[model samples]
Target: MQTLEGMIAPKFSLKNEVGEIISLDNFAGKKYVVLYFYPKDSTTSCTTEACDFRDSHEAFTALNAVILGVSADDEKAHTKFIKKYGLPFSLLIDDTHEVSEAYGVWRLKKMFGKEFMGIERSTFLIDPTGTVIKEWRKIKVGGHVEEALDTLKKL
Candidate 1:
């Protein structure tokens, strides 16, 4: 896993769920970011995690933070996933896994004895200055929003 704290996050310009190009520079000088990398959209664990962030959208807004979910899935899939779950935040389509690799969440995994490259669920808290302040790798879905919010509140 990449250690992100105190380091500059790699910049990215990716398609969001609405098929709009959302770039890291778009958030600069505007909002802090809760940038989360999840395995896939609409999966059980991913759904729970997305919903948690959705439920806390108001709180995040209050803190001037925008939540962005990223996955290897494409924009259409992300759009469907967002509509299905009423996800309040933007979901970035990392089709090439470039951003995932930059964040070091894309990894080799084994499931049912089949090994493949997949995203390791993770979250990064980026301050308004665009520096990473906190990072959670191999994240547990339960109560994760609270944990992230707690750190944001302190900031």
Candidate 2:
């Protein structure tokens, strides 16, 4: 809930779309990690954001950054979403919501006068050293990828 910038990122190992386990340590000292937490897969905003990342995948790779999406979606759903959108990045499955809690993105949200617990849609930019360098909480999908990309450019 507080600023994670300059702090060591929360270490995690979760299953990706293909059922491969992925850990934050995997990117440490290798590439900057763009770990983004979304609400769900195949939803309108999520799909648009994922597609945006897909479109700019090359630029991020060229900058030595790996984009990882996280949500409570299961492996099957993630795989389908990736296949449908042709996502070029790994989408970590946070089925237990532990990772979201660690990152402080899991909180009470209201929609249509109904309150419920869900992800707030956040993104953390972790440098190769595993320190969180930049973060955006309660993110709006529009122009968000560009904002994240620009921040990485500064680093």
Candidate 3:
């Protein structure tokens, strides 16, 4: 994967669960963007990660951060997942995998001895200036939200 730290995040405008267009520029000078890419919605790991973020939503908001989850899932799926989990943030649809490819999170993977293309669970912390300040690739879900919060605290 390519390094994105210290570089301006690739621009993207995707529809959220409510079909509202959300662009990288929307938060450009206001909030730090936590752009996380997961393989799918409603899966085991994805649910955990999303819940973790949901549980810490206020903490992130206090620090001027906005969490935006991305996946190839459609709006209906995203809407269901968010409502089921009471997620306070937006889940963007990247149904074409265009944003995933730009972020270098779309890749070939092997599961059950079969290879396929999918998202590698990853997170990018983009500051209000739009520069990616930190990134975690192929990440474990446990304690990740806290880690991201801690990084923001240190900043």
Candidate 4:
């Protein structure tokens, strides 16, 4: 896998829960981006992570940071997930997994004794200048949002 810290984040444009086109360029020079890639929508761990981010949304916004969740799930799934969880931030549709691939989060994995390709839980913190300042891969959901928030506070 390639290291992303201290490097420019890969650019991407994809539909959000509302079917609105969202791009990395949209937040450039405006806010720090917490770009997170997860395995699926509405799954246990995914939901926990999303809700954690949602609960901390205001804090992140106050710090000039925007949270964006990405998954291979489509817009409909994202919409349901967002509405069900009352998520304030956008959940992006990464149907092609291209964005995931660029971020080095898409990979081969094993579950239930079977091997498959999927997204590895990951997060990237990108500064307003578009450079990735920190990255977390294969992350556990517990306390993850707080960790990200702490990192942003020190920035």
**C-alpha TM-score for every candidate:** 0.97, 0.99, 0.98, 0.98
Q: Count the backbone clashes (under 3 Å) in each candidate.
A: 0, 0, 0, 0
TM for candidate 1 is: 0.97
Worst 10 residues of 2 by lDDT: 1-10
| Model 2 lDDT per residue over 52-124, tens place | 9999999999999999999999999999999999999999999899999999999999999999999999999
Q: Model-by-model lDDT, in order?
A: 0.91, 0.95, 0.95, 0.95
lDDT of 1 at 124: 94
Give me candidate 4's TM-score against the actual structure. Answer: 0.98
Can you write out model 3's per-residue Cα lDDT over 13-126, one digit (the tens) per residue? 999999999999999899999999999999999999999999999999999999999999999999999999999999999989999999999999999999999999999999
Backbone clash pairs for candidate 4 read none
lDDT of 4 at 88: 93
Model 4 misplaced regions, further than 4 Å: none
1 or 2, which is superior by lDDT?
2
Residue 22, model 1, lDDT:
90
**Off by more than 4 A, model 1:** none
Clash count (model 1, backbone only):
0
Q: In candidate 2, how many clashes are counted?
A: 0
- In model 1, the clashing pairs are none
